[model samples]
Target: MHVFYTPDLGDNEFYSLNEEESKHCAKVLRLSIGDKIQLIDGRGGFFEAEIISAGKRRVDLKILSRQLAYKKQYHFIHIGIAPTKNIDRLSWFLEKCTEIGIDEISTFICDRSERKILKEERLDKIITAAVKQSLKAYHPQLNNAVRYKDFIQQDFTKYNGNLFIAHCEQDSQKLFLGDLAQPNQSYLVLIGPEGDFSSEEITLAKSYGFKPITLGESRLRTETAGVAACFELNYINR
Candidate 1:
């Protein structure tokens, strides 16, 4: 069954599905009255519904079953990364990370960051598609671009879990993610841009208690490293 993203979802409430979603359901899928479809509110709620009215412009469904999702026993992976030099590369990272069930994402403008401004509208579309494709119930939250200093300065009080910063600086402690990460806790990892984090920026991150970690022996591109870190944490807990 094809899953649809419906933010206005509610129990026993009739929602006129969005035009694009309705078109896919009614025209593309050729679904009719009484057909079953799955709906997610992108907020940890899942619903099994049966179509009440099937139209070209809208599809109405009655909620047949509802499930309140539980938080997974895996770390809530949050990646603070430098945007890739290319917009497409950054967009690809967003899509893959969402599919792997990232909790949140924050992009920062580092001294070496080549791309600063991001297109949130397009990123939202990619996230929505990834959510549906991955069969995930909640959409990952995306934060607007923030400066490196401001981003690091924000209180990480809620993030009681471990924090890591992947840097290429010499003599920095090499952290094995296996030893640092655990299941069911919030985790944050920082990936630097093309030229890497400046020494001063690294010092600030260390002062903020973000332990320096290395991805592996071979260096990775900004986008690749971000996705790699996301999957590494996700797999460990799953």
Candidate 2:
């Protein structure tokens, strides 16, 4: 069955697809009336429905059955990193993380950040597509870009002692994230920009109880670091 994202599908017995979705469902997929398809609300709502009316402009479906919290991850993974100069790199990072199972994402402007602004709407669309591609029921929350200093100051009560920052700086004191972090807990992993974080930024993060972690021996780009950290955590939790 074809899968479609319908984030706002409330408890209505019948649902009409949006214009873009309608065209894709009817014209592109050529799904006709009585065809069955799957819908996800991106909040852990998975639904099965049969098309009642199929048209290029509109596709109406009658809800058949629904399940909540479908294939939900027990652990939460939130990665905060600096945006890449090329937005596509960030898009790549988002897509990979969403498939690997992330809970939330935030972009923070570091002292050495090359790109400070982000196309959040575009990134959101990429994430949505990734979720549907991976058949995920929960949509990852994407936060707007925030300055590094301000972001580090916010109270992460949910993550608690799981705060960590990954940097390119070669420090023997830095511990492997895999060894330091415990499993099945919420995480807040921060990755820096192309030039990595300034000494001052690292100091400030440590002041807020953010432990310094190493992704690996080799130096990595901003987006690569983000993906590495995401994979590292997910691998550990596995």
Candidate 3:
């Protein structure tokens, strides 16, 4: 069944697809009246519906069966990383992480960050596409970019034990994230930029109780490290 993003689809029997979705349904997918389709509210709402009307501007459907909390993951994965130099790589990270089951994302500008600017709108579209492709019941939350220092200093009293910072800097005390993260916990892991987080930045994060962790032996790019951390957290919970 073809699935469409319908975040606004609250409790309703009949719904109309917006212009963009309508165009894709009518022209691209060639779906017409009486066709069966699926709709996701991106917040645990999964619905089955049959199209009643189709047009270039709007597609109306009568929702049949509705399922809530469909395939929702148990653990919460929130990754805070610097934006990659090439946005395509960042987009790849976002897509893969969403497919793998991430709950939240935060792009913080680090002291060594090579790319300071980001387009949230574009990133949102990428995440939405990934969610549709992966058929996720929940949408990942994306936070606006903030400075690493400011991001770390915020009240994380909630994630005291689950908080981590993935850095390349040598630290004998550093533990593997896969081994440290416990299941069903809310995790917030920070990743640095191409140049990596500055020593002073690392110190500040530690002072805030963010323990340093290593992703692996091989050095990873900013985007790759973000994805690696995301995958490790998801994998461990699995």
Candidate 4:
């Protein structure tokens, strides 16, 4: 079944679809009256509705049943990384990470990062598509790309979670992610770019209470590391 995300959904109600969604339902999918579809509110709410009117400009549906589905809460995994130089690769990471259940994403401009700038508008579309594709009930938060120093200084008070910085540099307390994750606690995993975080950058992270951790033995790309961290957290939680 095709899942469409509608955050405005309420209990046992009907809603008129947006222009874009209407076009897709009326023209692309050619959905007619009485056709059934699923709607997720991205807040653990799912609605089963039947199309009442499949207008080209406005598609309307009447809600038949609405149920609340519990979302993943074992841990909140936030992956902070430098966006790959290739936008496509970064987009791929966003899609896969959302599917695997990442809570938040922060992009930093590290000293060794090849790409320093990114467009949030484009990234947001990719995230939206991913959320719908995965039938997710919550949208992962995405932060704008910022300087490495500025990124580290933000108030982590919102995150009462485990903090980890995944770096390639040699560290005495390097532990695999599987060994560190604890059930039901929020987690934050930081990943660097292809060039990796500079020594000074790593030191700064450590000073800011970010624990140094290792993902695996082999070297990985920025996108790969992000996806790996996301999947690892989800797998452990599951």
Q: How close is each model in CA RMSD to the real structure?
A: 1.6, 1.1, 0.9, 1.5
Q: How big is the RMSD of model 4?
A: 1.5
Highest lDDT against the true fold, candidate = 2
Q: Please, what are the lDDT tens digits per residue for candidate 3 over residues 21-93?
A: 9999999999999999989999999999999999998999999999999987778888998999899999999
Output the better candidate (1/2) by TM-score. Answer: 2
Rank list by lDDT: 2, 3, 1, 4
Residue pairs with colliding backbones in model 4 are: 42-137
TM-score of each: 0.94, 0.96, 0.98, 0.95
Rank candidates by TM-score, best first.
3, 2, 4, 1
Summarize candidate 1's per-residue lDDT along 1-238 as a digit string, tens digits: 8799987786655666899999999999999998898888888888888899999999988888878673544457889999888888889999999987798999999998888888888888889999988878888888999999999998886678488899888844878776788777899999999999999999999999888888788888889999989988988887
At residue 111, give the lDDT of candidate 2. 80
**Model 4, total clashes:** 1
lDDT of 1: 0.86
Query: Residue 6 lDDT in model 1?
Result: 89
Instruction: Report model 2's TM-score to 2 decimal places.
Output: 0.96
lDDT of 2 by residue, 1-238 (tens): 9999998898989999999999999999999999999999999999999999998999999999999989867678999989888888899999999988899999989887878777799899999999999999999999999999999999998886999999877766699899988888999999888888999998899999899999788888888888888888889888
lDDT of 3: 0.90
Off by over 4 Å in 3: none
lDDT against the true structure, each candidate: 0.86, 0.91, 0.90, 0.85
Top candidate when judged by TM-score against the true structure: 3
